[model samples]
Target: MSQTNDYPLSAVPQSARKGFWSTAFVLLGFTFFTSTMWAGGTLGTSFSFGELLWIILIGNLLLGSYAAGLAYVAYKTGLNSVLLGRYCFGEQGSKLADFVLGFTQIGWYAWGTATIAIILVKLLELPEAYTTPLMIVFGFGFCITAFIGYQALALLSKISVPAMLAFIGISIYQGSIDIGGLAQLSNISPTDSMPFAAAITMVFGTFVSGGTQATNWSRFAKSGRIAVVTTLLAFFIGNGLMVFVGAFGAMIYQQADIVDVLVAQGFILIAVLMLFANIWTTQDNTIYNFAAAGCNLLRTDKRRTITVVGAAIGTVLAVFGMYNMLIPFLILLGTFIPPIGAIIMADFWFKHRSNPPSLDKIKLPAFDACGLSAYAVGSAAAYFSPWIAPLVGIVVSASVYALLLYIRSAQPVAKPSAS
Candidate 1:
């Protein structure tokens, strides 16, 4: 299919025929080289051996299943998936969905820019004063690439993915030789007490909110089977690779920063390449989604909005002190993500009974106060609950929405008079 200047909103058959391997590679690149892994690096620095193992086992099981399940839903529901929230949130409720997704994308873009700045400063031994300017330059560069849209982003992924994978392979091979054996590396851990649950949350949180962006990529898949296969492959392989490298780093180096660990391992070139590649993949998607959300809310040209807003926000965050607050920012993403997934799944699967109406013919069903109430309650429950906020939020919201639908259906309708 030929590339177009306009943003393609619908899934055209011509665009959907990308080969399975190509799709798989793109998915793998995106998932593997994300900030979540960097966040996991921090987690690995704190968690004990047994606890980290438990987190990897349980968190991967749960989150990987969720990613596959949501991809299946997207396959069935199609392009206007987010708009299906009309059944629960009213006609305007979808805007709230857009805002949540958009705001998070902006945050991710800012974080990516900061990560690039951090990598460059450490790599070159630059002073603190140079970090902000470098970050702004990186941010602007990412915004320009993202403003070019999906095809450009896909090409970027193709180039970056192989280079990153090769670098990772080289690092692992060298690190294993230096450290004696793989078994010795596998047995080692951070030697500190970090909650297993927190580790699990970080793994799940990294990709859970990604459901919103699934359609953006999957819409181009040739079939539902392709989407399912590609998504499962990406989530499992990508996350597995991240944890594997994290474990290796933990076993060999005691440093808290992953870049430092890479440099110490004599893989400084690979370190810089991986860092840049990872940040670019993440920033592209982040800016793309932010622009899409703006178009949805304002009915404006995506190119204009994305370029202007992405550059403006990216520049501001790079200039200000936002990147310095990574943990708090990530925790905030963890908090609200489950609710959006809950609402999307509930609206598309249950209320519509697995058949969403045409996008052009969309109807705003009566506002489900019960559903909205459940979201509020669920969000609160997530905050208060000690062990499983994500699970609680999903259950509460779904149950509330289901109950409301049942009640409304049970009511008898008035009969019309015959002339």
Candidate 2:
């Protein structure tokens, strides 16, 4: 199939829609991310096991709901985030959304690329000299499925999700035994304390960028309801598993990452397999996200070409140490990315009435002041807010966009200056 068959520049046709399991597995694989485990590890250190569960449940619920809202819009219109941006952000202004969203995905791609390479060397006791070569190999290799597009992603996810779950279940079972079971695990105390708000922000921030771009696949859902359910399945349940695994490891073994915990538990072989499956699933999705955004940014249908280019860019970043910058990158994502989804949702519900016009059927403005303005305000609010920044960004931006729409509608026409 052609790159255009991926529909980089247009809405997907009804004939192209996928079934529930296909959509669900694709999204679930994307959510089975290692960085989320790291985020959970951070939370594990700061909260009791009971408090961690509460935080994970609440945070993933918020994340799932936010993704599901966008998924419904995507399913209705068959347009991803960048295409939706054109309606609210206008033709030219949408490029801002493209760059911001695209950059974050690449950052994540780079970090994941760097992480697996580093972890492999450490775990296998390979020479330090192997790190760069492994990074080079894995960085491009992981995008192979993504370069093949949605069908390949679904197949890989269908296999990897179950396998990863099994690996996690074994690790958790072993961890429980080593730590003297769940009762003792729960009674274990936190080594540190953090505000609940900050914890929520970390949990939400960890995947908000991916959730925003998930529309790239959600747009292919058979129906809006399917999109919503699939999105929630991935972001809520799948992502929640990542958080739980990380926190569980930290609480029992004083290791926040599942791979490290696995090695600590003498599961070296399983650790290698888990790392490959975990990183590959997310890496393909991440690079695919960059390609989608890149396509819209460049106004081209060359998604395959863009995929290669993105992998190269990410590989370079990974080689130069993208892994070390993860926390700050995630914070930046949480602060700025949610507003893009917020504006798109507001435009869909308020301006489009949940039924946006076809991209081919209309000529969009060069810029929509309402979207650009609201995004700025929302990002600024999120940056400064003492509350959970991502949630704050979404609420503030959507409210501003709705208010702007209302104000615009209520205004009287000037009647061509009484000509």
Give TM per candidate: 0.89, 0.98
At residue 301, what lDDT does model 1 achieve? 51
List all candidate RMSDs to the true structure.
2.9, 1.2
Query: What ranges in model 2 sit over 4 Å off?
Result: 1-4, 417-419
Which portions of model 1 show Cα errors greater than 4 Å? Answer: 1-17, 186-189, 256-258, 301-304, 365-371, 414-419
Instruction: Name the best candidate (by TM-score).
Output: 2
Q: Candidate 2 on 113-195: residue-level lDDT in tens? A: 99999999998889999999999999899999999999899999999999999999999889889878788867888998989
Candidate 2 lDDT score at position 16: 91
Instruction: Report residue 323 deviation for candidate 1 (angstroms).
Output: 1.8
Task: Determine which window of 10 residues in candidate 1 has minimal summed lDDT.
Answer: 1-10
lDDT against the true structure, per candidate, is: 0.66, 0.92
Q: Distance from true position, residue 31, model 2, in Å?
A: 0.7
